[model samples]
Target chain A: MIKLLSLIFLILLLIVGKKRGFKTFITFYLSIFLIMMYLTFMKTGLNAIFLAIIICLLATLVTLFILNGSNVKTKSSFISIVFVLLLVTIITVFIGNSANIQGFSLESIESIGYYSHDINYDMTNVIIGMYLICTIGTIIDTSISISSAMYEVHENNPQLNKKELFVSGMNVGKDILSTTINTLYFALISSFIGFFMWFYSVSFDFLSVSKSFDQNIIQLLLSFIASIMIIPITSYISSIMIMKNKK
Target chain B: MKKYLTLKNILIFVISLTIILFVYNDYFLYKTPILKINNIETTVEGYGSYNEKYYNQKITGVIKNGNLKGKIITVNNVTSTSGVNDEQIHKRSELFIKQSNNNIYSIIGVKRDKYIAILAVLFIDLIILVSGIQGVKTLLSLFVNIIISALAIFVFQSNADRLNLLLLYIFVSMIFIITSLFITNGNKTKTYSAIISSIVSLLVSFGLSYLIINIHGRDVTIWTMDYIEYVRDYENYFYVCILLSGLGAIMDISITISSSLNELIDKNFKITKKALLKSGREISKDIIGTMSNVMLYTCFTPIVPLAFLAIKNNMPLMRAINYYGEIELIIVLCSCISIVLAIPISLYISTYILKKYKKEVVK
Candidate 1:
């Protein structure tokens, strides 16, 4: 099934995106391989959070620079994304440690329950690493969108001041904000639907269900927070960089 | 710095900080007993059968809720540095406690809702502060969509045995597309075009996936799915997941294309259909990679830890992929396909609706 779907996806990408489609296909696989390597490296007992940060930077470079090419937009996007990534990492570590949702949920335990959890690495750091990696994609997407759109706006209206450009970027960010949030919300919900159904099937009450769902909810909320923070910050930074380039 | 000191920004920050501070300290609000750990004494460290290290801690804390308010209790906690199955109980952390026989209390879990609440407050305040009115509407649409989804889940929970869950999801998907687009974009030609294009694209993509799945037949592994024991019909549930997962990206693409094309048309009334199509393709081409990347990461990232665990347990790569990675790959690939397919479908639909229809009405 995976093979057939990938073939179809490749065909569709070729038909619609053509060269860029092929590029996306490669980047997608490259990211997967990168993640696989990150996981393998994590087993060596190096600092998981630090390794995750490096992997995130590498992944961002691959996604933004490779896919979009090294242009002004990509550069500014890269800068803002790194800024946001670092900022979000601090919050991730703090919240992740306090929340202590590092291990598998009771729902997932049924499948992998037989396996040994003695992987010799801190699950808390590993889970925090996952959060950091998970958020980089959307952060890159949001930053690039804002930067590219702001670049266009500045090019079209060279007379627009920095404030005007910043406002325009905000307008664009506002336009995409809802849909972006929707994308994140649905993706998170769908991934965990099985757990939700299980919660329902077993007839767990609301409190217990919410308790069990805390782990997933925290992840979703963190992603949302990251993307939201990226918007204004990217818009402001891109506007400043674009205008500064004009001078 | 002066620009950053706007009244609204100051208000948002102050309000959010106040909320965070209040939530962090308001443990009395909970009916369940909360234990504030004052001391943790590590009692033991040993190796398990797999040579895994573990630690045992004796924690002393004071209860902050229910009849045991302000009463100190001691509980035993076993943990490991890995913190899987058990976590190192930090001093000064609050936990939920349950009373066992002989009136002894055991820690249930950490009280982390205060942190979640703080984050939620920050997220909401930032959205409103940055995006202003659109932020409010976006949140409103989110609230509506969340309620609708909850209702859909409830419907599925009750009717899992009797109903066609896919059909229910299709209906819910429509409501989702309509409510979200309408609330966000308001009542406009662009919104209508987006709604039409998204629905058409969803149906077409879902049909393609269904055909592919059918052709692939029943040899696929469904048992590797989490919580599979509770699912009644694995095929239907799988389809539901594929559809719901792809819906957001599909809608996002369609709306973006339709709105951009509409903006193009609105700016240049004499633009040719060929030019419009070219522009739509250009816009979607730029978006498709990142959008699919979003799908890929969102779907694949959650399973990384599980894959790590499988590898750590010495499961073979192929067997591990067979276990869970295959499912995530399929979900992501199908979503990518839908997102890729949505580009052309939405372009054609929007051009016809926004261009040809407007021309016909003008004539």
Candidate 2:
């Protein structure tokens, strides 16, 4: 049943892609399929992580190229975003791995220890790898956004100086801050609503819940805070790079 | 601005007093079994005390509602473990009560729903104060979205066929995307473009995930851990989760792209198709990275603590990743896939549809 449903879904995507025209549909389907392939074939932690990084970067490049093909401004911004992403990924891994936030096992693990125990691998590396995989998408998204908006501002007022362009980028960043934060927070919270329900079902009081805020919640909070913190950094870098290229 | 006390202030004061009185009267003097603090070590055996590490408190409270109203009860309130700080119950805290045969009630745990509600109220208030009417509309849209989601879940749960659930979800999500976009932007062209791009992107990602799950057939048993047996019975719930996980980020990106494109078209009616396409690309390049970050981080948040747990337990990274981290990994992957598609999806639809329609509508 699951396989049949999946096949149907695949066919639908093809139809939609076909109807929409080849450029949009081909990359749209290919990018997703390639990522899925990497995830399927790569069992080792490091292999999967490296492949994911490559896949994400490729997707960013392809999408940006298709949307704005060989545009210097877009390409430069993409490079800047990639540089910032590399930096952020290192920082996140270093901080996250050593933070000791992984000390507490999730409640789900307590019951199904069998599944995880069967694998003989460096789970720590995998955890870090997963963090990198998760963190990269947002970093790419943020840098691209800041750069594009700044480019638009420059286009609108060709005479606007570098400093003015930088300021304009900051303004765009400010307008998006709240909604971005809300989307991030809401997405996490909504997914964990069931997890929260479990805690409540167990009669864990506020203080108890707080006490049990544990590794998972802490890690989540840290990841989000770190991601949000990167927005300004990426925005700043992208704006500066775009401004320099304007001349 | 008079110095004298106003009606709102007086009313707040009265409500405060009433709450204080209620807590004191109901939790204290009127109840038979009363909670008393212990400065020394004490342990209460059975279901709540198996951990042996938590500081157990003997709690006493009267049944304030239901058939066993006014009946006093005493039970061990176990402190939840693993949090950075200890969780303690307070006067305003609500507890889940279970009644035994002899009219005795078990104070299972603290009711967290109320606290969550209180926090949400505070969050909404802050938004309203800062953004004014815009915040209210955002808040209303959020509430409606929640209601609609709950309705979707109810409908899905009542039905048995997995295919129906999937189809229902697609239909429901279509409604969701349209309604949410309409509420947030209210411009038909932008809304239409956003809805189309979002759904298309969602379909592609969801399809890929379904493919991954079917072909590999890896150990998804981690999802069925703890007390979540329902996932085992209803596999489609997992797909539902995958589908909805990135909806917000995808919608946000599509809307941001479409709306920005609409603005560009409005700015220059005489702009050529090539320039317009370039502008659309420019817009996407700026937004896609940040928007993708939003999606990735949301999925990554849950994994942080799980990693911490594995580290602390002396569990190897491989084992932990296999069991605890798989779901988080898949969610991130699904979201990234959707986000990648959203950029082009939004760009093409917005450029093609908005440009074609703009000359006629003159908006």
The TM-scores, one per candidate, come to 0.94, 0.60
Model 1: how far residue B330 lies from native, Å: 0.4
Q: DockQ of candidates 1 onward, in order?
A: 0.62, 0.10
> In candidate 2, which residue ranges exceed 4 Å CA deviation?
A1-182, A185-247, B1-54, B60-73, B78-94, B99-105, B161-163, B215-219, B222-228, B231-233, B360-363
Where is model 2 chain A poorest over a 10-residue stretch in terms of lDDT? A114-123
The segments of candidate 1 whose C-alpha lies over 4 angstroms from its true place after superposition are A202-212, A244-247, B1-18, B25-31, B49-51, B356-363
lDDT string for model 2 (B229-306, tens) is 433234455666667777777888787778777777777777776787777765454444344445544464345434
Question: For all candidates, what are the clash counts?
Answer: 0, 42
Cα-based lDDT for every prediction: 0.83, 0.54
TM-score of chain B of each: 0.93, 0.78
